[model samples]
Target: MEIKEAIALIHAEGLQAGTWADLGCGEGLFSVALAHLLPPGSTILAIDQQPVKPLPYSIPAGISVMRQQADFSLTNFQLPALQGIVMANSLHYITDKPNLIKRLAQSLTDDGTFIIVEYETTQANPWVPYPITLQALTELFREAGFTNTIKLGERNSVYRSGKMYAARISR
Candidate 1:
C-alpha cells in the first residue's frame, strides 16, 4: 500500500509525540505514517531482522528514526518502554500470539497504544502462515491484558482477497 493509505489506516486524534517502535517495519511504510501522526520531536524505532531501507516518505521535522536489525518475535528480545508500538503485517509470522502480545504489552508505558495492521481473514497462505482474523485478534489482545481493541480503519487489499484492518489496542 501507499504511504497515504498506510497513514489513513492508523491515524487517530490526540496522539502525542513520543517514542514509538514499529516491529517488522519492512521498508518503514507504517513507521513513516506513525511519525506523521505524532507531534514533532518523536522517535520511531524501525526494526526488522533485515536491513530497512531509507524511509520512502518525508517525515515531519524532528521525528528521528532509528533502524534496528533484530528479530522482534524472540521472547528474549529487549525493548525500552515506549508510548506506542506498531505491528503491520508482521504478527502473522509468529506462531505463538498470546506470549508475543503479552511480552509486547510489558514493553509499553501505561496508557500506551498498540496498533496492528493485519488481514481480516483466518485462511493462511504461503505469505501469511498464521493469519489472525479481527475476532481472533481481539480475543488474543484481551487475553494479553488489553482492555480495548478499536478498529481504526479498513481497506480492500490489492494483493489479497481479504480486507486489511488497522486496530488500536489499549489497556
Candidate 2:
C-alpha cells in the first residue's frame, strides 16, 4: 500500500502520538509519514540493517528522527521501550519469527502497539523466508501475549499479484 493510505489507516486507529519506531525502514518513507501523523515532539527511530539515506520529504516541526544501522535478526541487538513499532515488508526475512516477535513485544510499553505489513500468502520463497498467513500472524501474536489484533488495511501486492495485509497488534 501507499504511504498515505498506511498513514490514514494508522490515524483511523486512534494513533495520535508516541515514541514510534520503523524497524527495517528501507528508504524511511513510512518513518517520515509516521512523523507527520504523530503528535508534536514525538520521536521516530528509523532502523535498518543497511544504512538508510536521508529522507526526501521535509520533517514536521517538533519531531525528531534518529537513523540507526543494526541487524535486528541478531540476538544481541537491543530495542528501546516504545509506544509503537512498525515492521513493513521486513518480518518475512527473519527465519525465527516467533522469537523476534516475542523480543519485540518485550520492548514495547504496556499499552504499546505493533503494526506489520506483510504478504498474505502461506507460500515460501527465497525472499520470503517465513511466509505467514493472517491467521498464523494472529496466532503468533496471541502466543506472544498480544490480546488485541486488528486488520488495519489490505491491498494487492506490488511485488506480486497476491494480496497483502496491514495488521495492528496491541498488548
**Most lDDT-accurate candidate:** 1
TM-score of the candidate numbered 2? 0.91
- What's the C-alpha lDDT at position 97 in model 1? 89
lDDT of 1 at 43: 92
- How big is the positional error of residue 109 in model 2, measured in Å on the Cα after superposition? 0.6
Per-residue lDDT of candidate 1, residues 42-136 (tens digit) = 89999999976777778888899998999998878999989999999999999998988888889898889999999999889998999998899
* Model 1, position 72: C-alpha lDDT score: 94
Report the lDDT of model 2 for residue 60.
90
Residue-level lDDT for 44 in candidate 2? 93
- Local distance difference test, per candidate? 0.90, 0.83
Cα shift from native, residue 8, model 2 (Å): 3.7
Candidate 1: the clashing residue pairs are: none
Clashes in predicted model 1? 0
Off by over 4 Å in 2: 9-12
Compared with the true structure, what per-residue lDDT tens digits does model 2 show for residues 6-96?
Answer: 5755443567477888999988877877787778878999999897678776779999999899888788888888888988889899878
